[model samples]
Target: MHVPDGFINAPVSAAAGLAAAGAVAVSLRGARRELDDRTAPLAGLVAAFIFAVQMLNFPVAAGTSGHLLGGALAAILVGPHTGVLCISVVLLMQGVLFADGGLTALGVNITVMGAVTVLVAYGLFRGLVKVLPRSRRSVTVASFVASLVSVPAAAAAFTAIYAIGGTTDVPLSKVLTAMVGVHVLIGIGEAVITTATVGAVIAVRPDLVYGARGLAAPLKLRVGGELVDATPAPAPVEPVAARSTKKVWITGLATALVLAGFVSFYASASPDGLEKVAADQGIDKKAEEHAAADSPLADYGVSGLTDARLSGGLAGTIGVGGTVLVGTGVFWAVRRRRAGAPAPAERETV
Candidate 1:
């Protein structure tokens, strides 16, 4: 959920900002351990994909809609640390460029939509993967469940935050009930998107999917009339060409572009779960206008563009491009840090 300005008092918002900053700092370190040549670039694409998919909001209730939060999907595809960064990137882009989320509420959005969702979804996903059969289908199933739960978990997080810093006098119980109830329906949409995306990636390149790694059952042998674990054979050395991620990367980027640039036009126009709840629960009574409302790309449309399709489509494309660029740069830097090498500029000087 994109929390707008003035919804939370300054003190609580500042606290959340500190918490979100701490989480981002921790994730940057953790991501160094997770990012590699194969995953670093893909992580950027994942952020772009999340941004693209989020534009296609699906109807949840009569007047409410929902979109992919991307926490579970990213965690399943990359890793939790990287997933948090991905959602944070998307949120930042939306806030600063699209004016979709408020500048002052950036921390609240990141805490609820980025940190909380990734922690809950990834933690639950790992637990389910351990108990379930180690199969691709099981990974998809786990993803579905994890994503479904993450939405409500984020909703609850927002409710708790509001309870502490809400600007209005709405009843906590009413706000919680409404937020959780509406988001439960929204969670279904999140689950479907996560499951399909995870399943598709697992089918094509399971190695690229962090959650699906090591899913293949180990070999077994019969010894002395008892089945025993077989010694693992040395993995075959794959050719450089065979290990290339260019194809998948290109395909994924293309898919994201298509989704944001075109398919988003058909998405439901209904207010999303958070917006609906805020309006109904009086959470927006003191909501302030986005600081970036005057930006050319505000409201997901280009300035002075008459054609809705052209304006929105262009904005979406620009957003995808910008997210991929920024995300890739961040992840690549983390990968370099993990390798214990200086950045390109430093290396050049050395």
Candidate 2:
């Protein structure tokens, strides 16, 4: 959920911003271990895709709607560290370019939506993956459950944050009730999207999915009349085989473009979970004007295009393209840095 300005006080927003900045810094390092030629570029596509899907808000209640948060989906596809960075990038893009989320409240959104959701979802996904059968179905099931829980957990996090730095004098209990209630419904939508997307990706390329790496079922083997678990050996590391990431990157970018450029125009215009909760709980009484509201591309519609559908479609396309290019550049640099200094002996011998 995109938190607009004035919901939280300035000090809390700054504090949250600092925390988000720190998490992003740490994720950059962690992504190095998680990223490679294949996954790095794919990571950028993931960000753009998340950005695109978020535009399409599916109806949750009669008047309320929700969209893909992408925390669980990202973590299941990539890794938790990278997932946080993905959502953070999307939130930042929306805040600065589209006047969607508040620039001042960027930290709040990152903390509640990015950090909290990813942490909870990834932790749950890992735990389930360890206990459940090592099958694609199990992975999908785990992803669904993880995604279901993450949304309410994020809502709880926002409740606590609002209790501390809320601009209005709304009742904490009411805020919690409304926030959790609507978001729980939103979580189901998130679960379906996360499970379906992760399952589809795993079906196509399990090797590229970070969460499914080295995952294998332990077959039972009889030895000396006693049953034993025979775990499969880890696959050998092959450097050259990792170079196929370019295709995945291109595919993800293309998918994002198609969704944002065309599908986003059909997105529901109803208020999202956060907006509904805020309006219900009086938390939005002090909503501040966005600093970037005057931008040409503000509000996910082109400035000159009078046709609502055409204007929104053009804005979505540009956003997807910009995010892909920027995110791809960042992730490519990360992969290059990680690909440094192939064996020193090999270098010296060469």
Candidate 3:
């Protein structure tokens, strides 16, 4: 959920900002191991796709809706560290450019929506995959379950945070119940989206799926009463050209653009889980207006476009493009840091 300003007191918000910063710093280092030449670019596409899908909010209750948090989906497709960065990037873009989330509450959104969700989902997914069969179906199943749990877990995290730094006098029990209850419904939608997306990717290019890697080891066959590996030995790493993800990246980016630029128009207009919970529980009593509320792109609409469809479409397209550019730049920089020689500062100076 995109926490707006004043929902949490300034002190708690500042603490969360420090936590978010620390998480991002740790993720950047961890992502170096996850992002390679081929996967680095895919990380950007993941962020763009998450940004797009988040626009298509589906109805959860009569007046409540929810959208893809993208933690599980991103973690399953890429890796957890990169997944956190992907969502952090999207939240940042939405806060600064789109005004969907408040700038002051950026850390709250990042902590709850990015760090918590990714950690819970990735941990659960990894655990489930270890106990289940090592097939594509198993991976999809894990993705679904992991996604389902992550939403409520994030809700719980928010509840804990609010219990400590809430700006309103709402009862902690009420907040927890409402938040968890609505988000559980939202989790179903999250599960469906994550499962379908992960399944599709696994069907096409399992190699690109970080979680699915090494899932299905070489089968063994019994020979002369002894079991032996049936699959051929692994081949050497492919060249950068041979391993390029041009086709997949292009296809994913096109899908994101289509979803955001067009399909987002049909998404539900109701308040999402957090918004509904806040309004009902009085957690939003002190909510402040977004700093960018008057911006041209605020509320996901172009400044001059009168047509609702055209305005939203242009805004969505711009968001996708910006997210890709920024995400790719960040991920590429992280990858290069991993590949480049030691910095002069770290080297022994004469």
Predicted structure with the largest TM-score when compared to the true one? 1
Q: In every candidate, how many clashes are there?
A: 0, 0, 0
Q: Kindly state the number of residue pairs that clash in model 1.
A: 0
Give the lDDT of residue 227 in candidate 2: 92
Ten residues in a row with the worst lDDT in model 1?
335-344
lDDT of 3 by residue, 292-312 (tens): 998899999999899999999
How would you encode candidate 1's per-residue C-alpha lDDT over 177-276 as one tens digit per residue? 9999999899999999999998888888999999988889888899999999899989999998999999999999999999999999899999999999
Scored by lDDT, model 2 comes in at 0.89
Q: List the residue pairs that clash in candidate 3.
A: none
lDDT of 3 at 58: 100
Instruction: Please list the C-alpha lDDT of all candidates, in the order they appear.
Output: 0.93, 0.89, 0.94
TM-score of candidate 2 relative to the true fold: 0.93
- Which ten contiguous residues of candidate 2 have the minimum total lDDT? 241-250
Stretches of candidate 2 off by over 4 Å are 229-243, 341-350
Between candidates 1 and 2, name the one with more favorable TM-score. 1
As for TM-score, the candidate ahead, 2 or 3, is: 3
